[model samples]
Target chain A: MEFQEAWPYVVGVYMSIWAVLLIYVIVLQNKLAAVKRELGSLSKAVERKG
Target chain B: MKKSSLILASAGALLLMAGVYLAFFVAPDTVVRIDDRELVQFSQKIFYFHVPVAETSFVFLVLGGLFGAMFLGTRKRSYEQMSYAAVEVGFIFVLLVMITGVLWTRAAWNVWWEWEPRLTTFLVLTLMYSGYFVLRSSVQEESAKARFGAIFSIIAAVNVPLTFVAGRLDSLKPVHPKVFTLQGASMEGPMLAAFLVSMFGMLLFATSLYIMRLDLLRAREDIEYLKEELEVG
Candidate 1:
């Protein structure tokens, strides 16, 4: 906390940045997994069609 | 594990480390105290690493925007990948500059942060890049996301130079831009070498990270494509 005198805004700023980046990465992961699941289901349907 | 990419990335890392060694250890420290109330350090040691990488970030930012524009124009996946890659690399380096710059500013100017034009512009540019990434992820449809991204990239690119120029000249009436050149000093020999090496290393680091991330993105795409193929059969 001593450093706060030197840098009042930095701790908050850093956390905000990482939080945003973390959210972005999580979203990407979620999307990728969902897409994979959809593709897997579609494949099973096509196997029946063939 | 492409041979050339790996080599470039490693070489960049090595040179950057060497530059760091020279900076903190080799270059002389300069303290510029303003009005006795605050001191600004115009040191030789920090400059070698600071200036080059800062300059390099601009280059990468422009490259990223250009690729983003091209991807929009051509609808090419590679261009989109390039745009993403360049921004990621640029963002990483810019983050370093901001961190280092803050320390220098505190030691020299007796302030941790200021609404200084350059710093403000850098912050804006960073936010813009983050927006680009956020836009990319917000959409699930590839073509639609790329289209919007391409447009955003073009707009962001158009603003990059304006933001930088405005930051520099934010004061001078018709000539409002601040003309604060490195009014500090010239760096020669070992100091310059260190700066150049660090710049090269940062660039290489960005490239390597881009390639690795890109490989993952492409692999994911490939898997998606295979799934579609199986479903249609």
Candidate 2:
């Protein structure tokens, strides 16, 4: 297959790979930050009680 | 994220980029020679990413099963968390595999999907593992949820190998390509290098994600425990 002929499929595959990975990493980062925030608040609550 | 997982993720990203470069520039385009003609398979470049993602998913799911077994044997919370994390990360890779695979199928076979042995078995494998999450969420008790999830993970892992071999089995008449056989891999030279680099990169990346998710699960558990203690006091 010539590059011209195969470009669509090749581009689609790479695009899907990177797009899915980028979305997943972004989601994971946001979830991690949220967890950290919750944990920090919980620690403060415990400290105040103590 | 932990320092170790961060380093792993960075290294994995670097290697994957190198793999892409090698796959495009260094690896020779696939060619087939007939008596009077040569055909170049440009779309075959997708192999560099597709196979690696599929293999990585298999590795994670297998690890998920192993962790599930450990949890069952020791009744440990950490093992259960690890198993869940592995499945979640593995599921992401599996989805990528399906997407890239569909593109490849269309390019090579002129069809988006075929109900062949490999494809059917793989679809079943995906659905079975997906049910693992649904099973966990449906259960109300922590211990019971973990136990059922562990058992499901083990059972699901069994399907992974079946999916892998479905194409090769004699009766199946599969259209899927078999890259590895008893003798050796079918690829060589720069092609093999690209594949190996991508494979290891994907494994490391998935491991980093698994560690990150596991840490989050542990933190959530700790938060729940502290909240319960605070309420009791």
Best by DockQ: 2
Question: Which candidate number would show the highest lDDT if scored against the true structure?
Answer: 2
Listed models, DockQ each: 0.11, 0.74
Model 1, B65-93: lDDT tens digits are: 89988887788898987777677766666
Model 1 gets an lDDT of 0.64
Kindly report the docking quality category of candidate 2. medium
Candidate 2 structure quality by residue, lDDT tens digits, B96-143: 988998889888888999999998988898899889989999999999
Deviation (Å) of B32 in candidate 2: 2.4
The local lDDT score (0 to 100) that residue A17 gets in candidate 1 is 30
